[model samples]
Structure formats: C-alpha cells, structure tokens
Target: MSEFGRENPQFYLTAPTACPYLPGKYERKVFTHLVGEKASALNDILTQGGFRRSQNIAYRPACEACKACVSVRVRVDEFQPSRTFRRIIKRNADLIGEELPPQPSADQYALFRDYLDMRHAEGGMAEMTVLDYAMMVEDTHVETRVIEYRRRGPDSGIRGRGRGPLIAVALTDVLSDGLSMVYSFFDPDMADRSLGTFMILDHIERARKAGLPYVYLGYWVKGSPKMGYKIRFAPQEHLTGTGWLRVEGEDDAQD
Candidate 1:
C-alpha cells in the first residue's frame, strides 16, 4: 500500500452472493480499503472508474457473464426536470435541508433504523446496529457532508439545523467532477413526496451551484425495478463499454 503504483490502490474481490437487484443471479464485488491521507484522492479515482463507497470500502459489481450494472450520472448544468420531478419538488416544499457536519446522532440513527425497517428490511444493511450507523457517518477519509431534511421549524433559518423529526438524510461526497451521493434514505411512509427523487434533484442543483458538471448517481441496474428511477433524470450519461453516452428519449431506459 505504500507504493503509489500510478496511484492504484490495493483491490480484492468478494465471494459470490445472491444478487439483490437481479433475481437468480450471483454478484461479487471488487473492493479496496480507503485509509490514511491519500484515501480521499484514492476514493475520487475509484469512483470515477466505477466504484461506489460504503463507509471505508470502495466496491463495484463483478458478476460473471453480466454487465447490467452501469454507472450513471446527471449532467447537472444541462439537466431539465420532468413534469413529475417538478411535482415532487413542490410536494416537499415544506421541508428544509440543512447541511451539517458528518457526525451521527441518536436522532439520525433512529430515523435510519426506521428507514431500513420500512424500505430495506430484507436487504444487506438490515442488521446495521447503532454503532455501525455512527461509523458510516463519521468514519471517512474524504470530504463528506450530511444533509438532513426535516420539516421547517421556527428557528431553522437562523440556526441552520433541522429541529423536527428527520424525514430524509443524504451522506454525500464532494468530488472534483461532481457530488457523489454515497448513500441516502428517507421515511418510507412519505413515499408520495418522492424523497429519493427529491434528494437527487437537490444534489443536481447543489452541483450546478458549485460549478460542478455532474451528479454521480452510482449504478443503475438494467432490469431492476428498484433502480428504475435513475433513468428519470433526463440528459444523463450512462457509462458504457465505449464510454459515457447520453441517454436519449426513453422514459425508463435501463442500465
């Protein structure tokens, strides 16, 4: 790990497991550990090269004979919201997003627990304990921020912090190319507001304001309905065998 080796970080592959996105398929991952001062730089290179971060680990799908997992990103400066997206934005108008230090608290953990129970009960992160949640928030080598979305409170504008029950949370990484959404979750009961889409839209706007050109949306699985929303953001780029290509006029293009 000491030698830069053209800035290549050490990599390892995980054992095959049941693929959550695509049924009857096995999925493995090629991953690496991000630690020390160079971790941030390493993370940026890995993300640009198709890896996604979960805590200190950077990984990407490596299923044999399948390439359905394609990295996607919204061209922030050129993004045009669809009519549905606009509606979602309007629906969540009462919520205020406060960008705060990446420090996990009891409230965030409680919301995280509820989100996992409601949305991903059978998923891999279903069993993450409070300690795990804290590490997920605070254990980082890159520049990260936690954006907490809550109902507008009287003192929200002055204090710049959410006071009501947490409705949504996005742990984001500030990268040179764009803002990479490391992970995001919201109250599943509030599905009508489409908090998932709202968070992505917010990230796109935030990126545009910061002069970044893209908002990395991680991977979009071709046949996974759970991942279908990634295609809704128009004028996005999908990383293909050739390179990043603009998605054309398909409403729900798969990865």
Candidate 2:
C-alpha cells in the first residue's frame, strides 16, 4: 500500500564495510531496485535526491556516523575552463563522440573488460561477466544513451561517428536538469591524456551545448585521492544539509 506501487521497491541497508574512499572509516548504503514502468520517474527523483544508479539499482551512501559522500554537480553555464582543462580538449581534438542507443557490443565489452582489469582489478565490478556487462547497459528503463569515443578518420565527416579503435565509453542518463554520467571507462594505456578528466570536461561542454544547467558528477568523497579531481572543477554545488550549497574553496571538507 506504499506509494511505490505493486512492484514496490524494497529498500535495504548494506552492512558496514571498510570504506573504499577513506582510510579507517566504514561505509554503508541504502539501496533499492529501480525497475517496473515507473522506473524512469523514480530514477529522476532519486537522482535529484543524491542517489546513483547501477544496473537496476539506485543507491546512496547511508553511513551511520559519517556523511562523506556528497553529491556534486557542475553549473554548466557558469563553468569557465581552466588552462589545463582547455589543454585537455586541445589534446583530444582528433577524437569524436557519437551518442547511440543502449545496445551492448562485443567491442564495448572488450574495452570494458580491459578497463576493469587495468584500473579496478580489486573493485566490486571486477568479477562482472559479459552478461553482466550487457545487463548494465540494457537493464535500464530510463532515458539512457551510450557515448562512444574514437579517433577521427577520413570518413568521419560523413558518418559523424569516429573510426579508430574504441578508446572510451560513457553511460549517460538524460535528465530534466542535466545529464547524469552513470558510469564511464577509458583505455588505461592512454593515461597521458588523462581520459578520465577529459571525459568530465567533455560532459560539461556537452551540457552547455545541450543548454542544461548542470552536469551531475555523482559523489565526491573528501580525503579520497581517487575523488580529489572532482573538486578542481570550480563553481560546483554540493548537496549539503541545507540543500545545494555553492562550493567555493576546494578545501572545504563537506564529505
């Protein structure tokens, strides 16, 4: 009889586990499945409320005594690219991104596997199989798109899609406020380009072009080196206790 309907989403709390983002701290999550006909609408509301989607699950950190996972989103219109960000764009000038339907491909799976093996070998998703990868891309009922990045070729102008080997892929959700980058992966060998940062810069630009006000970047955990780069993007807003607070000093430890 709850508002979630017959296919009611059953919420559960994860047992406390070693924090992946912080040392000597534990982390927990409150999660629910995002399925059924109302999935898309439910997803939108949850995302705005700081939940992140993975496959068919919507989860948000719910640590008992810690609130280190702060959701941050860039205000696209007000974002001014730093010199480094501009250089990143210049360095990747030969690349092109094509937005396509959420269909799984062997090439994508290969790249995904390579990324996991090289970057997140010990992470939870390292054991994901090909079928799991497919479900990750196709299990969503929300408005999603896969952006494939590749090098430009002779026929690039005509086809509009890039032609080199698949270097990166981003699973994005189109929302009323902005685009949510659910997950993205790049070739680890191309570390010099800093593809991870480059992708984020690209998304910011993309949001601007699309006339969206913000580009949701999931969460930023303070004291976590892996998540430190997120603070470098100036003019970002963090979801604080008082609501979305404009963050000025990158050193402010909200998370």
Candidate 3:
C-alpha cells in the first residue's frame, strides 16, 4: 500500500479506458478511499503528491506506458497577471464570488447542465442527472466548498455577496497548502466573459488572502487543446517524476 500513516488505507487500480483528453490512447488510475478521522490530513498529503480528490476517493494517473497527465499548481504569491488576464478580470469585475457550504441547489444544477451540453456534450459527465450533480457537489469527506459567482447587486458591497442568477460555480477543496479546484462550470452564454479564466484568477487572489501559496489546477495534458489554457498562468509548477518543477516559459512543446 502507498505510504501515508499507520492506518494503511487500502488502494486499488482501475481498468484501462480510453483517455478523454488524448485521443487514441487509454489511461488508468490508482486510487484509495479518503474516509475516517484523518481524511483531511491524508487528503493534503495525497494532493501534494499529485493525487486529486473526487468525492471520497483520492486518485492519480497510473498509466503504464503514458505519463502525459502532469499535475499543475499555481504559485499564488509569485503570480502576476498578464495583460490579457487583467483584461479578462476587468470584464468580469461586475461579478462577485461567494464561498458557500457544499450544498446543492436547483440553480447550480441548471447551470451545470447547460455547461455540459455546450462545452462537453459528448463527454462522460454530459449524461449526469440532477441527482448526480448533487452528489458531485455534496458528497465529500474533506474540506470542500462551492463558490458561486453572480452579478453584483446594490447590497453586495456591504454583504460581500452577489445577487440574481448564478453565472458560474467552482467545486473546490480547501487543502492546507492551497485550494484544489475539483470541478468548475460556467454559464455557456457568458462565453465572452471568459468565465473559466476569470474563476482561476479569482481563486489565486483568494489563496493569497488565505496565506496559501499554491492553487492546484489538476492535470494538464500535453497536445490537448482543451488544457493548453492552463499554461497561461505563469510561474506555475508542474509535478514531474523528480518532483514539482517551476515552469515560466509559455511553450507547450516542453511537456
């Protein structure tokens, strides 16, 4: 079993399946349950070692012949937004994000369905019903939250919360080192706002305020157009075989 502590959590490996990110290739994962009193501490350790938490399970890529899925985390303290990133933030300045308990809502599910239908229509999560979406948000053992973004209202300045329809949602985990973005979805109609990038920028600021140094952005696969946007956040670290290494250049060829 993988080393964590004396508890010795049982580990398992999944059968090979077609990789969604890289076509014509298959992938596998090694995972273990994150339950019991020490779940939060164990999650922090596993996450730092490149494992991502999905519900109560912590998993990492275990492909035998391929290692394209490299874990990435933004160095929040060192991050300086580029001109393009600043523009995206400015465009989204009218919205406010509020961290809420891991509670499911009808509005969240509706936005999730729209996002899947537009962005990932043929993906695995496209067929998920409202119940599945609820489980995805509420079924967690570690410290997790749902950050909802909405249009700012007149009382937002005093209440620190937005009003009106929910435009975006981020299902995030609060690790000791930083925030781990498990999943995020935005209103497809707001494509011009670049909500995806804006959410990441907001998370960076949140981490900074919390005195956290990193913002884990999950796996970044080489040659995948969908994941290429992740590299735009400079001075980020990619988990290599040797350890976490700092990458600053905007070259996708290095991966």
Candidate achieving the largest TM-score? 3
User: Rank by lDDT, descending?
Assistant: 3, 2, 1
- Clash-forming residue pairs, model 3: none
* CA RMSD per model (angstroms): 2.4, 2.9, 3.0
lDDT against the true structure, per candidate, is: 0.86, 0.87, 0.91
Q: Rank the candidates by TM-score, best first.
A: 3, 1, 2
Supply candidate 2's per-residue lDDT for 74.
Answer: 90
- Model 1 lowest lDDT segment of ten: 246-255
Q: What is candidate 2's lDDT per residue for 139-252, written digit by digit as tens?
A: 887889999999998888889799869999999998888999999999989988878778888899989999999889999887787788788787989998788998853633
Candidate closer to the true structure by TM-score (higher is better), 1 or 3 = 3
Error of 3 at 248 (Å): 0.9
TM-score of 1: 0.92
Candidate 1 lDDT, tens digit per residue, 1-255? Answer: 466732466788999988989988889999988877788888888888888998888899888878999998888888887777788788987888899889998988988999999989999999999999999999887899999999888887898666668999999999988999999998888888889889998899889999999899899887798888788787889887787898843554432
- Runs in model 3 deviating more than 4 A are 1-6, 249-255
Clashes of each: 0, 0, 0
Best-fitting candidate, measured by lDDT?
Answer: 3
Model 2 worst lDDT run, 10 consecutive residues: 246-255
